[model samples]
Target: MNLSAAPAIEVQNLRRSYGDHVVLDDVSLTVPQASVYALLGPNGAGKTTLVSTLATLLHPDSGSARVAGHDVVREADAVRGAIGVTGQLSAVDDLLTGTENLRLMADLLHLPKAEGRRRASELLDRFGLADSADRTAATYSGGMTRKLDLAMTLVGGPSVIFLDEPSTGLDPRSRRELWDIVREIVADGTTILLTTQYLEEADQLADTVGVLDGGRIVAEGTPAELKRRVPGGHVRVGVADAVELDAATRVFPDAVRDDATLSARIPSADDLVSVRDVLGRLEDAGITSASVTVETPDLDEVFLSLTQPAAPSRTASTAKELS
Candidate 1:
């Protein structure tokens, strides 16, 4: 990707502290144009602090942040205009209808009366809140409330959006619904900076993921790259018959057989070339597989291993306060 194409967000030597408690330490990061960057850490790992600073909601003590090419501290207003923040808490006004809520946001953005109404209706439809447009937000489901909150954030058409644990407290279906919404939002060429404790969300939505621990980034890379860093990749293969399995067991001296399923789970790297090699070997032996699957290390594994905790008792809230 064009690294020089100007990032939607940029941070360097980012340091924040409260008294003697340091929340962030020389944290440097870049968010590419139109790409989704997931900032992940357990609760109190300073994920919220980093996000708030990037969104121009808070100032960093020593570090620098730029959103849409404007310095966050010196050009806070410019940064606010260039980016939209969907904070950890719902911004939706509970007394207003969905349409009314969006209109309120449009009005806050200084859109014309007619233009605000047009935009409000447009967002109501886009976020699946059209039918509920007239209904009070108090009666809306958690999923609906989140949709409306996100729609309200989009009224000004910001190029960058910061979502800080946007799916918190929702059921699985509601979380999935919000995930689809995020995908749609990014598909429209918007750059997203999402912070969440849910690893699955990051694994599913992020183009690049940065894992933070103890107020600093421990690792930053694509999902596959980060997975490759940990162990536990395997290949589970099903055979056509017991004879084929027996033959294959002999073919590969070190194979673990499952008597119930008539399959062998091979210990191997779960990479493309390795999979192709396994298939090629089966083809050479004139053997066919009833099924096959590749399993690798997931976020839980990666997080536990990477986030070794610089100091076991440090609080993420302390870090947040420093920011």
Candidate 2:
């Protein structure tokens, strides 16, 4: 991603409400060019609402947003021209064949007949649906249907794409295949804004993650950076014998030892300095055969901690302080 370039999507204190109920409250975020930014939250956390506002489908009640360098409210047409949206529900027409679907989307974008046919053929091959291009959408499996839906979104060749729960119902293998496709899209310089309930998906795909709760972005950072903010991180050291275990325990007095596994679990901040210190102490104690591994809280833990009811409002500075 080009850090020096203007962000593909930028929001400043964007807010939206439905009568007395606020769906998005003072939400602000930036999605870097040609990168994936994942929005994670509970069922009513406004992930979809945020995406809708950015896609120019819903007008924000307050604040401002720019998508693909065009204001979502003022330059709605320009924003629409530069982006594509694949919503939670599949946009594929069940009665249409795979190739017909792409061609239909191409036609809607005003491409010429020959160009529409070319794009349809190319998209069918690119998404591995060429073999079933003639089959109706109803005949395709869950995975194939989802692939076709995404392919239709790309028919316009948009610079920024919004995927709202794109992998909601697929099996594990299908989900992984979709992840690979998303990676390929980003590699080709497309910026993506994705919303998902799957914590692992965000960890695997996002360059940055924003945890929305109570209609606010409570935390935002890279997957690794957010994981480091949660506590309970430790280093596990395995020893060959009881003698070595005893020596290692002496070196780390506060470590939790397990006789059954002959390992010592030493508390750590999950940082390089703490890991280097542990290894240096083991070497000094002549425990040369020890095997070490660092363990830190995963995204699940980070999500739960940051979205707690009493969790304070967090800025980038607050996130660093927690880390």
Candidate 3:
């Protein structure tokens, strides 16, 4: 990511409400150019509201947001021109052929007829949809349809894309394929703001993560940094035999011993310094028959620890409010 370049998206004390129900409260974040910023939050946590506000589909009650160097409210048209949005629901029209869909988007953007056909062909080929170009979207599989929807979003060559739960309902393999596409997009210098229910998605794609809860950003940092905030991170040293286990235990007396696996679990912060210290102590004791690994709490744990469970009523009402 280019630290010298101005941020692709910036928000300051952004707030939104529907009557007495506050959906987004004082949400603030920044997404750098050519990077992925993943927003993780539970249902009814205002993730969609925040994204809608930034995309200019909805207005903020207070605070401000700028996307692609344009204020979301005052310069809504310019912001819309510079960004593309892929909502949770597929935007593919079932009756249209894949090629037709791309051409339609091109028409909406007012591209020249010749250029529109050129872009349609390029996108179909780029997204591996050339063979299915004439196939109606109704015939496309879930994964293929998703690829096409994303492809249409790129027809205008948006500098920044908003992917709201892009991988939702996809199988594991399809989800991974989508992740690869996201990486490719970022590599080509397009900034992405991704909101996902899958915590693993954030861990894989995000350069920075912001955890929203109860209409506010509860935490923000890199995946590793957030994981470090949670407890239960430790290092496990595997030994060859019971004799080696005893020797290892002597080196790390505080470490928990597992006789069955002949490993010692040393509670540590799972940082580089701690790993080096563990290895150094083992070398000092001449315990050579050992394998070491560091284990830290995953994003799931970090998310669980930071956010509260949504009430059933709030979940229903929040959906209606956003709609």
Candidate 4:
């Protein structure tokens, strides 16, 4: 994750349209080297279109996209060489064993025969599929199938990986395990561009998040920064009695008080130092609160605020392609 180097992925003024229906509109963003960047959007928000264009699967009508320093169009082969893609659906062949699947990917990558075998073995072990390596992929569980699919993406040792909703249907435990795997990948200095349905997944794994809406990135920043952009942050102080509550309210004149809950909600940025300052000032005024809690807007709130207004009524068809 060297910030000194050039970015791994960059797009500028990208636009794509299908029969006069615009899917991507003036989209632009950059993904730093060896970091995880998550692109989030509701159905029809053009997330998949962006990923496709960047991966060199689709051509943009106008504008430019580059991956791993190679232009996706003029240098498609170089861009392809530097990247691996794991799409929303599992790419595993049902009849092949987990070991066979890895071997297949290695063969596709044109690795030497002996090297392919070694690489397959390493991936089987790395993805925890060693025990079931010889078993057909058809019988593998959802989590196992996902791991095998992701492992296949790594057969070429790509510097940049595109994961398009890689954990879409996994259970909670499986999802967390996938997140752990993502962390490991970025730690090895591999940049990843992930498109996911899970907001919590972005919050947990992304160093930077881009919120796409109406065929463009509506917002892009660190999770905390985006959350801070939305309003909802405050500190709630619960006092022991009405006397303490009244004293705290006077100090925080703008606070909203709730007599029934014996609490006062003071609008704040919710940073640690600010929260501590509020508590210290209350203590100096000889008012001790029963409890103090800080609440900030979460990704759900940010997502809602940013996309809800522009979101179209989604359908099964919209989920598959850009609007």
Candidate with maximal TM-score? 4
Please tell me which predicted candidate would have the highest lDDT against the true structure: 2
- Candidate 1 vs candidate 3, TM-score winner: 3
Residue clash pairs of candidate 2: none
Q: What is the lDDT for 123 in model 4?
A: 86
lDDT of each: 0.82, 0.87, 0.86, 0.85
How does residue 267 of candidate 2 score in lDDT?
70
- Angstrom error at residue 22, model 3: 1.3
Model 4 deviation from native, Cα RMSD in Å? 4.6
Residue 215: error of model 3 in Å? Answer: 1.4
- List where candidate 2 sits over 4 angstroms from the true fold: 1-4, 237-264, 269-274, 280-291, 309-323
lDDT digits (tens) for residues 143-245 of candidate 1: 8998888888899999999998988888999899888989998999899999888889999999999988777787888887777665565667788788888
At residue 132, candidate 2 shows an lDDT of 99
Off by over 4 Å in 1: 1-4, 234-294, 309-323
Candidate 4 residues lying further than 4 Å off, grouped into runs, are: 1-4, 238-251, 260-262, 269-273, 276-292, 309-323
Candidate 3 structure quality by residue, lDDT tens digits, 1-323: 55449899999999899998888878889998999999998776787888889999999999999999999999999998988888673578999999999999999999999999999999899888999999999999888888899998999999999998888878888788888888999999999998987789999999999888778777788998888766666789998898889999999887899999999888764343366777888989988758888788898998887776777454433433321
The alpha-carbon deviation from the true structure for residue 264 of candidate 4, after best TM-score superposition, in angstroms, is: 2.1
